[model samples]
Every structure is written in C-alpha cells, then in structure tokens.
Target chain A: METARISTWQFFILALGYLLGTSFFFRIGGLISIAKQDAWMIPLWSGIAGVLLVLIWIKLANYYPGNTIIQICIQVAGKGFGGFIALLYIGYFVHLSALITRNLGDFMKINLMPRTPIVVFHVMFLLVICYAVTKGVETISRSTEFLFPLVTVTFLLIFFIALSEWNWDRFQGMFHMNIWTTMKETRSLIGFPFMEAFVLMMLFPYVKSKNRIKVSFILANVVTALLLSLGVFFTIGVLGVTRASHETYSLFVIVQEMHIGTFFEHLESTIALILLIVIFIKLSISYYCAVSGLCQLFQVNNRSWLSISLILLVSGLSLGFDNILENIVFNREYYFEYMLLFAVIFPLLFLFLTWMKKGKEKRKVVGSQA
Target chain B: MIWFILFIAVALATSIFMMVKQKKSTKEIMLFSTIVLLGFADWISIFLERKFNPNHWIASFIDWISL
Candidate 1:
C-alpha cells in the first residue's frame, strides 16, 4: 500500500488532467467525421455517463479503503482468481499508457520529426516516464496540479485565437446524418476518457482527504467534457466537418488553420505543447499505477527495479499497430467492448461479491453475540 | 540495424547494472530481465522486418466474432 496520500485537490487535478489529455485529438476528430456538425454533443453525453460510472468506481473503492483496485481484488476474490484480476487491471494500465505513447509517437513522426523513427519518440518519452514513476505517485499528482491549469489556459488561448476563423455556416446541416448511426458512431466515447476513469480506482484510496473527492471528480469530468466539446465544435466550425473528419488529430488541424496574418502563423507548436503537457500527465498517472501495481503484487517496494522493464515492454507493445488507422479503428469499433470488461463489468461483479461477503460477516457477528 | 541493436543492448545492460547496484532482490531482477528481454525480442523483430503486431490479431478476432 502507498504511504503517501494526496489531497482531494490533487486527486481532482490528476483526474482532470488524465481526462483532459483530451482524447479528442484522436477520438473526437474521427467521431465528428461520423456525426458531422452535431458531433460536439457526443462529449457532453459521454461526460454524463462517465460521471455516473465513476460513482460506481468510487463505491467499489470505498469498500476497501486504503487498498488499491489490485489489493481490493486480492482481498475480495481468492488469491488465485483475484491475482488474475489484479494482473488484468495492471495490464489495462500498461495498455492504455502504451496506446497514448503511440499516439504521441505518431503525432511527432507525422508532424514534427518525419525523419526520426517512431520508436525513438516513444523511447525518449518512456524514459522520462520511468523516472517519474520511480519517484512515486505523489510526485506525479503534485506536478499535475500546476500543469493542468497551464495546459487548460493555453488550450483556451489557442481556441480564442482560432476564433478568428470560426464560421457558423460550417454547422449549417447539423443533423443530416441518421440519428441511430450517429449514436453508434459515438457510443465508444463514454468508454474512453470516462469509463477509462475506471482505472482511477487504483489511485482513489491514496487520496488523503476523501470528504469532497466525488465532487472534485464530477466537476473535473464535466469541465473536461465541456472543454472537449468546445474543441469539437471549434474543429468543425473552423476547419469544417468534412475536412476535420478526414484528418487525424483535428485539434492540430484547427491550430494549423489559425492565422493572424503571417506574423502569427504556424501555431502548431502551441496546440502540440498543450497536448504533450496533458498527455504526459495522463501517461504518468497510468505508468505510475501499472508500475506500483506490479510492485505490490510481487512484494517489491523498490519500483526502480520494475519501471525500466515496464517502459521497455510498453514501447514494444505500442508499436503493435502498424499504422494509426488500425489503432483508430480499434478505438472506434471495439475498444469500448474491450474496456467494458475492465471498467464496468469486473468492478460491478466484484462489488456484488463484496456485498455477499459483508452479509456473511454480519451473520457471523450476530451468531457470536447471540 | 546493428547500431539500433547496440542501443538496445546498452540500455538493457545499464538498467540491469543500476538494479544490481540498488541491491534489488534476485527474484525481482529475474522478473525485470524476463520482461526487458521480451521487449528486446519484439523490437528486434520489428527492425528485422518480421514485425509482429498483436493488434492485427485482436482486430481479426473482433472481425471473426463480429463483436
């Protein structure tokens, strides 16, 4: 178990930053291409669903206070099966971190450093992440406290600057797409940043002050969703839905479209800066969770022994997809179902088992007293 | 290709030496070596042009299951 506990505000910032890496860069771009002008609404809807699912995650975490999801699994389920579940959760953390790392790799290779191998970007970033993870979770969460505000402020600035090119006419044919098709196209989102919060259960127990943790989480989710919604709306409005839908990383496209004469052109760096900062925080949290989970399960307190190996493993797994298109297809088509197992299904199943165990304990107590 | 292999070898060697210096238990070192080696094998496969992509397998499974 982690000895260092963070304040509720730190938890809020970590969660907010994690969610705000704004998968919108990859996810909403593709979704807007699907839902067209009305796609911005998807983030809002996903945010609400994400908020409700987070309540379930918290309920499960509170049942075993001070225990991480991995620890909770071992306690609730027998060691053999519980160990499997714990490993699965650890795998989730590693897998998500890898996917995001690959996203950064792809982004860099395409936009900035075309000559450099994609693996180079991943290796450099993972090396930094390995250092952060070994320092422990408190250090990472505290760093997010400042980075969150910085990234959000710059994100707002970028949006405002891009407002020069915004066009209401871009939204002219709003709901021309079939309703059911739009819903199908966007359903995977709730599983994304939201159900993805399912992983945050690992960090919930380490929050020192739990008094307003739920409030902080809910507010953070809502704020991130709204910000991402604005991003979607801005992407469609500025670059037009047709173009943004086809392009990967629509947010970058919007920033590229931002021009205040030649003097203020090529602000790709600003948008990339925002994405990198927030994604770093998100990646750090997941990296920390995975490494620590491995340590606890194997009874090793020295995380440095494991962080480097995990970094190497993730870099290799991240390249498992040959192209970004394959990854996007997985995210859009099957990722929700895959995530559902770890996010909602297993958590709820464990919650039910917890209730049964509690009932049995109460019965034993009554018999003893009688 | 040879240079990239050397980079992997040097990285793995440095990391192992750091852990040994930190006096990590043998069991932990063994676990670390196993994972890092697996990672090394995968990376080498990619560079060797016999790339192995687990995503393709999962995507195909998803398609086959129609899920």
Candidate 2:
C-alpha cells in the first residue's frame, strides 16, 4: 500500500499553520492581559518554554523515527488500546479544526464584513480549504512556501509601519507587575500559540529527513515567537494598553492610521486582505491535519472524502458561535485547556509511554542475545 | 437562499461521490456523512431557531440531542 508523504518544507508549513493562525489575531490580549506593561517578556518566557517542549517532542520522534503520533501510540500501547488513543486524538483534532474555523469566521465577520452574512465568509473559507485538502498536503505546503515570503514581508512591513507611532508609556514599568500575575500569565501564554506547535508531531511521519528535526522545530518556534512579539508590541504601542484588548486585530488599526503621505491612508483593507490570505493558508493546513488524523485512525483507504465532509461540518461549526463575544468567552473559559489536552498533554504523555515501551523492548532483546 | 442550499447539496453530493469512488467501505462513508449532517443541523438550528417559531419541535429535538 502506498502511503502519502510530504517533504520537509511541508512539515514547516504544518508548523506555521499552528502558529500563524491562533497567534496572529489573539496573541495581543493574551500577552497584554498577563504581562501588562512588560508584554515583550511574555514572548521571551513562552519561547523558552516552547523550545524546551518542542525538543522533548523531537527527542521522542527521534526514538521512533518515521512514525506518526498515531502509529507511535499503537507501537507503544499495543493495537487495541493505542487505536483507542488514536481515536481520541481524532476527536481532538476535529474539535481543534472546528474551534479554528469558528474563531476565524467570527473575526472576519466582525472586522471585515459587518453587513454581509457570516455564512458567506464561512462557506468561502471552507470551500477554499476543501479544495486545498483534496489536492493533498503538498499543495498546502507549497502554497505556504510560496506565500510565506510574501506573508513575512507583509508582516514586517506592517510592523515597521506601526513602529512610527510607538508609545513607550504602554510598555512602561516593565517588571512592575506582581510576580504571581506574570507567572500565571506566562503559563497560559506558553500554551496558547507557541507550544501549540506540538501539533506538528502528527506530520512527523510525512517528512523524509528525521535528522535535524529539532533544529527546525526550535527555529520555527523562535520565528513564531518573534512574530507574536512584534504583533503584541505594536498593538500595545499603537492602540495603548487599554484599547488594545478590545481591538482583536489591533495591528490593523495601527496600520489604518499609517500614511506614507495622504495618498496612502486607510490601509486597513489592504492589510486585511493579506491577513485573510495568511489565515486561509493556516486554515487549510489545520483542516487537512484534522481530516488526515481521522483517516489514519479509521484506517480509511482514501482521505479525500474526509475533506469534503469537513467543508460542510466546518461551515456549520463556524456559524455555531453566535458572535465574537461568545467565541472569546468560550475560548478563555474552556477552549484553552481543552486544546492543551489534545495538542500538548497527550503528545507529551505518549512520548513518555513510548520511552518506557522502548526500554522494555531493548531489555527483551538483550536477554535474548544473552 | 436557493443557491446557498444548492451549493451545500452539491458539496455533500460530491463528497458522497468521491467517498464512493475512493472505495471507502460504507461504514466509514456513513460515519463521515452523519457527522456532516449532524453538524449542519446544529448550525442551522442556531441560525433559524427563533425566527422560525413554528419549528420549535424541530429545535427542541436538536437541543435534546446536545451536540
């Protein structure tokens, strides 16, 4: 049987999917809410934690090279039980995609199209996602590789544009926040977007080279951290600490005020289009992962049908949230911990389980040789 | 409105075709299809619950299922 494989570059895209989507819009409130005036510290702390966790994941992958998380679970925990764990992961992945779709839909509706029905944005986004998944991971990966340069350039351009309006008062008293608040926020910050890159474990089976996976994973986390920092810093500086929390994509508001001259004003729409492109790329990869995990768990012969099914399912999920307020409320209340369980906790647990299994297997081999 | 419904129907139909053509066993296909329908029903209920007051029975049944 032929197994579909993706190149190293695609793996990078898969990681980008996890980082760019969740962090892009929401990282500001998450950072400022915790770090207060010392928002930059949040990224530094989270990056340290993120890199360490990713290294743990890399070490596990090295132990069992070329196996997906589901495959590894089965190897470590035997067929029946491992398959059940894999099924649980499938549900987790599905819930994740639903949350992402719902959030993106909420953001787009509130920010870009107030008059147009929310379903319009939802359908269009999912339709594009469905098309991308049908083409397979390579398409999404290549698209990410292709657009990554533009996205980066646009991101930097926007960051610099906001720099002109920097106000240091928003970042004043950098370390003055109570230590407990900072530490608590630091833990929540670690999970939201940075450590969430742990989801890339599922894609480990597809990449050709197992060597240097750690280097790539750490590099991805660092780059993501820097981007998140840039976004949060600019948001706080431009919007001020108070208003920044209310502005979901506060970076856009800063850009709206920007003008090289009078001719270049009201730039929010252009920025929105670029972000829309980035979000779509992010969504496609994530939706693909959710579908692929399901296919593998069910042992389905072809996964393309899963993509089509997701189109409808995601469309519905996106609309399930009544508005941005409910979405935001749910995210903080339940979604954060829920995501950690599947994306972070389970993978870490599986890593430990795999390590124990390998030790036992090694002992058995040594005994036989003796 | 008609176009929207037709578009969704077409998407579901295409998925069904691809699902069959790919030769996935009926069980898997059915599972996927059921998820799609269930998710769609959940969304539509939220979309039209109060506006279509006459359909309270349908809404109540969906609520009972509790997605």
List per-candidate RMSD values in Å: 2.1, 5.2
Question: lDDT for each of the candidates?
Answer: 0.83, 0.70
**Which stretches of model 2 miss by more than 4 angstroms?**
A1-10, B1-24, B44-67
Q: Candidate 1 on A1-370: residue-level lDDT in tens?
A: 5687899889888888888685757776787877889988888888988888888887887788878888888999978999999988887788888888998999988988899989889989999988988888888987888777888677788878888888899999886778777777787887688888877777877887775778888898998789789878888888898888888887887778777878988889887877788778989888888888888787777887688888778998898777988888788888887778888888899999999999999999999999
Judging by TM-score against the true structure, name the best candidate: 1
lDDT of 2 at A224: 79
> Deviation in angstroms for A46 in model 2?
1.1
DockQ values of all predictions: 0.61, 0.24
TM-score between candidate 1 and the true structure: 0.93
The complex in candidate 2 yields a DockQ of: 0.24
